[model samples]
Target: MSTDLEVRFKNIYPGKYFLSFSKEDLNTYLKFRSWLPGEEVIDGIEKAGESNMNCVLRVRTNERSFIIKQARPWVEKYPQIDAPVERNAVETRYLGLMGEDVELKIQTPELIGSDTDNFILVINDLGGEPFSFLYEHNSKLTGEDCKSMMAYISRLHQLKPVNFPENMAMRVLNHEHIFHFPFIEDNGFKLDDIQSGLEGISWIYKRDKVLKQKIESLGKLYLGEGKALIHGDYYPGSWLKTELGFRVIDPEFSHIGHPEFDLGIMIAHLLMTGHSEEIIPAMSRYSSEQAVDNELIAGFAGTEILRRLLGVAQLPLKLNLENKKALLDQASDWILSGMIRHE
Candidate 1:
């Protein structure tokens, strides 16, 4: 039978309409879900996190609350940056994949409901305390937290790569942001606008022809097909601290690729955040089931640091320009040295 709400949703352009939602819009969206309480009004709905590619919100009622995430064609913060709408579906599949594993579920969020037509996903809201800010002050992470994160990555990598075409789109997008744009001599990212003197830090890497060529080679390796499933964007921003513990979020960039890319990116963030002391310990805790190429991992780590320092995605760091430059120099050393040994 035809209904008023059904007709309403049919008219609401799923892509553009849901960009910023109201309580009424959310109510209409959840009309068909069994979890929604009958005859009860929604209390409030608000955005949950800061994201450049998706709209993440928390919808609440007297009965319960859940997170609603929808991916858009362009970055929310920087509209010029184009991203695939299908990446949200890839994230849903990734959550489904991890949900299948008993241990992995402990370290990840559960998928509750999803609307593929709108590229929106509903998942259990793991309260909004992101560990990314911990990097701002050199906060120490417990051994257990470090171990759980790396172990989760290791477990995911152990799984054979599945055929998911949507993930490839994210991988290509990630490759461009992480490898290509950051090194361009005049690629047009105004780093100083993000922070005073930030642009000066990139002068060395941006002008170095040799470093650019080396980075291009790393980009090629990133584009190569591999067998392990990887959390393509395994950085501080994706890690959340909840009542349960540390839960990894945002696998929209997940893909079948070299496991080292994940490990490298982890170390890259560590080095940039002034947590290099923890690098060896974190690597040791990973204890991958498969053999890992240490040099390749170092190269990936260097590239990630380079990108974060100069690329469109910037981290909130409380470091002086001198310190930022020092980190950049260290990242260059890692890139040129191409060696990371736990021993």
Candidate 2:
């Protein structure tokens, strides 16, 4: 009784193969791929964390533990939403390229092995918790923490690899959510379900033609190519607080694009989580070889804020209706003015 996903995955390999949560099934598949030694015995299997795009599992063996990730034809968090399975290939390429830099290599997980045909990746489990706690009310990211986060991204942008994956599918999907869907008048996503009076607050921006035009322009910039390598989904969720230090994961949405997209995402999250005080200092800490366009960063940051507040990919925000409206107002100002006003 194999599901369509299991059947399709099996066809890609010789033996019966499909990633599952079952310990026995994972052990057999790992052994077949030589990812696990024949003698190794599976001790347990558990979910790694909250992942949106892929099935991520932490496989603990008698000797060692590692992570197994597989990308299917749909988003793992929301299966009805279709996505590209080849996104894993992009992540594999990003990891390979990052490994070339000493600083970046230290901050990223070691790529144990990969089966591109099955869209699976195996990497050493960097035991840690994601910085998702920042989403809680009144939570704050320390100065040192902000510094480390900025340092990793700055180093990552320094990479100048030739012929990177275009990642057009992921980009298109992201483009719709970030730049288009949330602004649509009747998109069917009920904002009031997330927060009372949120739907009313959202209408202000949805109807603003000037703001939408600016956002459309920024979206075009996002789809275009740039010289720097950006960690496409560079936020707290992808950042891990390990015993060693801060480690970054899930570069599946990565591409050669504007570095401000990453910085803007970071700024947006900081502002959303009540870390406004950290924004200016954090921006000061970010050191890029090329000049960063602050206005572009502001536009992207504002767009990210709107998308999170109004779109399907919601955060664990504890803001009240008033706070949300204020944020929306600020976001609109940032977008319309092309400036980040921290007053």
Candidate 3:
């Protein structure tokens, strides 16, 4: 069945070239786009990391290595899930904007080139592991890490762009997972499969009409436009830890949105990773040029926590059933009260 599916995926898009893990195929594709000079030979190709959205590869040459990302009609991690291939253009535009800013350019990977027809983006690989290890038991982000992350986001929110991709398709897809799908009692996703008793624990919120109503309202706010250009998915997975400092990547979901959306998502992850103490301090590190609405931030934070617990985008959480229940309850409270209470 998997072999058949692979064959079908390869030929799914007529006239559109799909990237494979083969060095020969990549050499042809890269050279065609002039991304690889004629003299530069392709040494090898390997998976860059665990990318959930696109096919990301590290292309090694005699001199150096670079990363190439190709977006398909469906998600690279979950082929059954549909996503927009144009996200490559969105990310390319974002990187182009970042390249103009001195601070942002230093913190993000350099965009080498792009193949618009194939939805492929070639970027200079910033070698380092993501900050995802913070999800492990006893792992915590240092004060410096928190400050750097906050500072990058703070600067990102301050950028003023004349035109930007609406990214409504990506936003709508995220809206379903973040706000609507998790609350559905019969969404076909089994929470217990992720962890025992998680299904039973999720019912406490799923059955709550008031909580769902609040989530629905927050969903509308998320789908609406805002003044700031915010990174749509500002989580640990998108943050890279390198020798210089923390670098940000994957702005495919980025759009003109409220700054609180970014702040709230970051805070939610910090809380989940047992860094609740860093929440207040991290906010302090954020730029005060734009006033942050704590209530809005709390609402988005709570929503993100609930979705990660009950939605398809499950984390590498080390918490047990009891701990998850406590978090679900706390997330509900934060959503309803519009206040972040760490206890």
Candidate 4:
């Protein structure tokens, strides 16, 4: 990120790129340049990931282009503070562990570089590539692709959780308080909106009367019965398509939750994107009564993410919806009714 290089890059790709890069981009690269003693001109910064604060730059030295990812924790110039950047480093390590089983395929760029603090991961950004956010097209996922995603979950689950770090449970859940962020109310431990969406199974937090008590109860059940590493954020944006098949990305939220937590939420996202509600049956292929059991996941997701959208961790889906009051109303209504009718 030399001064000259940054200026030149700005001039070259100056218009609306996928994500924007700025003067600070130069500072990150320069710091890495000094740290790497002999590393020659870290390649120019071209935008990579879908996130605004994420910068995917090319690191060229010996006739090779290495992808460098600079992920800042806070929302860029956002109104409120955001998630920690250290989570990106956690994701890098999580992917490495997962790669041991999946071989990572070619779908993921090589994880050749990293700066643990700010989460600057250098990879091989294939030009003929689209990230996961772009891949969850309307019913674009087929039976095989669906199975592939499911199988990956099963395999990760099969990995003896005992083999992980000593404090495996806490490490997996990380105790990060995501469910409460976007909500405007301060109603104790229960997320009023998330709790409101339960179609039938409503004895969650109230069964214990105390959130810590409820969390302890859920923790016991989750650890005792549920047997998988659930991707806390398994919505459409967490995977990608490669020459061979599909590969998942963004394991930062790799928490140990109910498997349906991942599956149902994904199906919910598909429906949100206007996929035929009839495709709801497709969810069953993953597990027994998956659609019903995981319903809470989507129910919670629509409610929770909607809050995030209204808060700080907004996604492109919000922009796509374009602040339309009608769509927002429909989303809110969808959560309450639990009916996803194809538009």
Candidate 5:
């Protein structure tokens, strides 16, 4: 390694914003792992994804390559969004736990190293775009694909982990957006600013006491005692389509909560993208005995749909205002009545 690079990296503080792996750091890390020749050098660094809260980069060399992920104290894009830095440790913990399960290990990236103090996690890179890209393009998953995905997640929840530290920080952060904000009249979000006429629709829903009561009840269930270990954000953005199969990533929001939360979020995204075929069968594949309450699942999914529609964090969906309003109406119906629509 060059002397200048060594000096620059050696002095790196843990809380640096947009923390990324430099070529020297990557080379040194590889050499430390004995994966590189003493003189081998990294050729380039490519950004992996648009992570607003963390830095993810793919480092490549003629010999080998890997991904470096580092979490910062605050969101990179929106400085106003402050979060606990320890969430990185929580993610690392989730990865380690998943590593112990053979099925999840195959579906998850291989964890190489994790420095809890520095909030850095290094793991193998699964190369491909998010499954979301395909969904957005109107591509559908085959029956086998849906089964495989459902089976993979079933294996996770079936483990029923009980002795793990709760990732309360991430869960709490997500709870605000998913449950609290959508029902509040002035939750500090300008919905119309995101898309035209969105604020008016959001206003109508927020002012509905009946809808708010239904959603708040669901929110209470979300914050209640643990039911099972769940991938808190199990939407398409977290599922990557690799040559091998679907690879799940980004479990930062993981928590010991209702398993239905994961299933509900997944179904909600599928609904938004117009891929409504596998809803029932996939749910059946994942359900075992009376473990998951169908009504609770519907309620959670309903809140998820409404939150994504009216809340601050928006998905890159290609729906017109009328279509979105229709979805909102459907979501409101489901939330108010606890009925899931297969259409």
Candidate 6:
């Protein structure tokens, strides 16, 4: 062991558990796994490539370039903010489990090293465009792009769950199928916010008790339906736009949840975009192109709704509304109508 190893570790990561490796070492291990080619070139290294909610950096050695991703258990900006560290570990665990199962239309970063404080990943920077950028430009995902994404999602759900080591205990699959229970503990949900959100929804929330009931019922289906490994945050931003096709990244939220959780979140964001008429055609076209059960979509929608309200990461639609009451109301309606089973 190098006498100064701890000193170097402290210089790179302060107050955190971490693993650091040189490109030569990283390459040697890759060859041991028969994953690296012989003639790779080293390039200049650059630092920091963060966006929206992740911390990223690039390391280009003669061998290859890898993107290092770090997940902050607490809110990145707000240190006092706390979220589950298990979320990170869970994502890594799921990726390892899904190794042979993933059909990569979009690329996922290759994992290199993993441990408690943080993990190091060496991934292909496929130059994929961000989903928010696509939305901002009003560029609807072409039927082809939609096709690939849907196919990947379908394949993910199609995989057999029986292969996994039966001990993980994903009890969420039980009949109860709790929604937002873990997050509601320390952080309080404001009643006024609910009232404000309800009001902004233009009484649609109050008028649609049927939708609410549907959401509740679907929650059961969500937990009990076909089980598989999922890319927990299957959003546009997690994908790339290229001549080759969509390359995916950011599986930090990955786990064994409803396939609908992945599907509903994407659809909810799509619904939030464009006006009512535009949204209908988009949803219809997407539904036509993708093979899915409306009942399942409704169930996933319910999960999406609860996730928006209580999940650590908030949706962009809510952020755009600006007016506190109006945003809450719109989000409330979004869950009830867009994501809820009743809708």
Winning candidate number (lDDT): 3
lDDT of 2 by residue, 1-343 (tens): 1376566546654473457888878877888889898688889998898888888999999999999998877788776678997699999999988777888888899899999887899999999889998788466666667878999998888888889999999999999999999999999999888988899888889999999999999999999978799999999999998888888999998999999999999989989988888899888888889999989999999999999999988999887899888898898888888899964
User: Which residue runs does candidate 2 get wrong by more than 4 Å?
Assistant: 1-16
How well does model 5 score by local distance difference test?
Answer: 0.78
> All models: lDDT?
0.78, 0.88, 0.89, 0.47, 0.78, 0.51
Candidate 3: TM-score? 0.96
TM-score of 5: 0.90
Q: Is candidate 1 or candidate 3 better by TM-score?
A: 3
- Candidate 4, residue 238: how far the Cα is off, in Å: 2.4
TM-score for each model: 0.90, 0.95, 0.96, 0.58, 0.90, 0.61
Regions of candidate 4 where Cα sits further than 4 Å from its true position? 1-43, 60-64, 71-73, 77-82, 103-109, 126-139, 142-144, 160-178, 181-227, 277-281, 287-292, 301-343
Comparison by TM-score, 2 against 5, better one = 2
Clashes of each: 0, 0, 0, 3, 0, 12
Candidate 2's TM-score: 0.95
Worst 10 residues of 6 by lDDT: 166-175
Candidate 6 residue lDDT tens string, 174-274 = 22223433123333444335434532332343345665565566655554534665676676667777667766666665555556667766665555443
lDDT, candidate 5, 202-238, per-residue tens = 8778888998888888888888876677888888888
lDDT head-to-head 1 vs 5, winner: 1
- C-alpha RMSD by candidate, in order: 4.5, 1.9, 1.7, 9.8, 4.0, 7.2
* TM-score preference between candidates 1 and 6, better one: 1
* lDDT (Cα, 0-100) at 319 in candidate 4: 32
Pairs of colliding residues, candidate 4: 43-59, 43-60, 67-123
Runs of candidate 6 exceeding 4 Å displacement: 1-54, 97-102, 115-118, 161-226, 275-293, 302-343
Decreasing TM-score order of the candidates: 3, 2, 1, 5, 6, 4
Against the true structure, candidate 1 has what lDDT? Answer: 0.78
Worst 10 residues of 4 by lDDT: 199-208
Regarding lDDT, does 1 or 6 come out ahead?
1
